[model samples]
Target: MKIAVDAMGGDFAPQAIVEGVIMAASSLPADTQLVLVGRQDIIKELFQKHGFESSAVEIVHADDVIEMSEHPTKALSQKPNSSIGVGFKLLKEKAVDIFCSAGNTGAMHVGALFSIRAIEGIIRPAIAGFVPQVNGKHAIMLDIGANADCKPDVLSQFGEIGSLFARHTLHIDHPRVALMNIGEEEQKGSVIAQAAYQLLKENKRIQFVGNIEGKDLFTDKADVIVTDGFTGNILFKLGESLYGILKERGIEDEFIARTNYESIGGSPIIGVNGNVMIAHGISSPLAIKNMISWARQQVEANAYIHIAQALA
Candidate 1:
C-alpha cells in the first residue's frame, strides 16, 4: 500500500515532515511505500542531509503550496499543483491508498467533499477525535469541528458512523453510542438533542446508550460520543488546554499524557470515499510518524469497506 503525505502542509514544512517520513519509513512494513508530495529538490536535499536512502520512500513534485490562511475552496481551485492538491489527486486516481496532511483543515475538508465525495448513504461526512479514558483506553467523538449545525437525522447518523469507526478502527466490538447532552435524561439538552435521542434509540445498527453529560466524557459510560461539531470542537479544545496546563505544571500521569495531541497523531476524516488523515498544523516529527502509521493500519483494516457495508 502507498500512503501519500503533503510535505509542504504544516507550520514546520519539508524539514519536520521529511524527518517524520524517515522515521516512519524505517518502521513501516516492507510492502508499504511512503510518497512525499512537495518540491522534489528540497525533499531530495533533506533526504540526503538525513542520510535516508530508503527504496520504500518516493518523492512526488508539487511546486505550489496552500497556505493555512487562504480560503479552502479558493486555494484548492487556484493551486492545482499544490502539495495538498496533488495529494488529493493521487487519492482520487487510486495512486495511493491514503492521503494525509497537517495543512489547512478547511482545505482538507473541502477537498474530501469535492474530490471523493461522501459515501452513498451518508448525509454528511464527520471528523472524529479521540477522547482519552481514565482506564487508559480512548473513546471516539464525532463531528469535531465539522457540520457544526446538524439536524436530528444527521446527529443520529453520526452515531452509526462513530460506531462503525470504533469497531473497525479502534477494534471495539458492540461500541456504546451516546448523545452528548446537558443531562443523562431523554428530555435533556436542546430540542435538537431530544430529537436526536429518539432517532438514535430507534436505530438498530448501533448500541444506543442514552444521553452522556459533559462530566461523563472521559468515563467508560460511552465508547462513542455523538454531538454537533460546535460543541464537540469546544470540548476537544478544552481537553487540549487541560493537557497543556498539566504539562506546564510538570505533572506526569499516564492517562493525562494520552491527552497530548502528539501522542494521538491525528484524526481521520471518515465517511469520505478514501482514507484521509489530518494531523495538527503544529505536529512534530513524532506526531507525523504516528499519523502515517495509523493511516497504514486504517488501510489494512479496510476501514472504508466496513463503513460502506455498515451504512448499506
Candidate 2:
C-alpha cells in the first residue's frame, strides 16, 4: 500500500511534517511506502539533518502550497501544483492508496469532491469523525464540520453511510445508529430531526437505535451518531478541548487522554471515491505519526468501495 502525505499543509510546514514522517518510517511494513509531497530540496535537507535513510519513504516534488487562509476553490484551481493538489493527483491516478493533509481543511474537502468525485446516489457527502468512547472503543460520527445545515434526507443518509463506515472500519457487524438531538424521544428535536428519525427507522441498511443526547457521546450509546455538521463540529471540538484543559490541571485520565487529537491523528472524509484524512492544522510530530497509523488502517479497510457497492 502507498500513503501520500502533504508535507507543506500544516502550520509547522516542512520541519514538523518531515520529522513526523521520519518517526513513522522506522515501523513501516515492507509492503507499504510513505510518499511525501513538497519541495524535494527542503525535504531531503531535513532527512539529512536526522541522518535518516530508508526505502520506505520517498519524496515527490510539488512546486506550490495552498495557504490556510486562501479560498479553497480558488487556491485549488490556481495552484494545481500545490502539495494538496499534487497529493490528490497521485490519488486520482491510483499512484497512492490514500492522501492525507493537515494544512487546509476546506481545500482537502473540495479537492476530494472535485477530483475523485462523490459516490453515485449520494445525497451529500459527509465528513466522519472518530468519537472515542469511555468503554475503551470508538464510535463514528458523521457530518463533523462538513455540511453545516442538512435537510432531512441528507441527515438520513449520514446514518446509512456512517453505519457502513462503522461496520467496515470498526469491524462491527451490526452497528447501532442513533440520531443526535436535544432529547432521547422521537419528537424531541427540530422539525428536521423528527423527520430524520422516521427516515432512519425505515432504512433497512442500518440498525436504528432511537436518539442520543450530548451526555451519551462517550457512553457508547450507539456505534454511529448522526448529526449535522454544525452540531457535530461543536461536539467534536468540545471533546478535543478536554486534553489541554486537563493537562493544565495535571489531571491524568486514560479515557480523557484518548480524547487528544494526537491519539487518532486524522479524520477520514467519508462518501468520497478514495481515502482522504484531514488532520489538525496545529498537528505535531506525534499527531502526524498517529495520523499515518490511522491512514494505514483506512487504506486496509477500503471502505469507500463497499459504500459504493451498497449504494448501487
Evaluated with lDDT, which candidate comes out highest?
A: 2
lDDT of 2: 0.94
Q: List per-prediction Cα lDDT, in the order shown.
A: 0.90, 0.94
**Runs in model 2 with CA error above 4 Å?**
none
Regions more than 4 Å wrong, model 1: none
Candidate 2 structure quality by residue, lDDT tens digits, 1-312: 999999999999889899999999999888889999999999999999999999999999999999999999999999999999999999999999999999899999999999988999898888888989999999989899989999999999999988988888889999999999999989899999999999999998889999999899999999999999999999999999999999999999999999999999899999999999999999999899999999999999999999999999
Considering summed lDDT, which 10 consecutive residues are worst modelled in model 1?
Answer: 302-311
lDDT of 1 by residue, 1-312 (tens): 999999998999878888999999989888899999999999999999988898999999999999989999999999989999999999999999999999999999999988988999999898899889999888989989978899999999999988988898889989999999999889898999999999999999999999998899888789999999999999998886777899899999888888888788888888888898888899889989988988887888767778888777
Candidate 2 differs from the real structure by a C-alpha RMSD in angstroms, to one decimal, of 0.7
Report the lDDT of model 1 for residue 43: 95
Question: Which residue pairs show collisions in model 2?
Answer: 9-103
Model 1, position 232, has a per-residue lDDT of 94
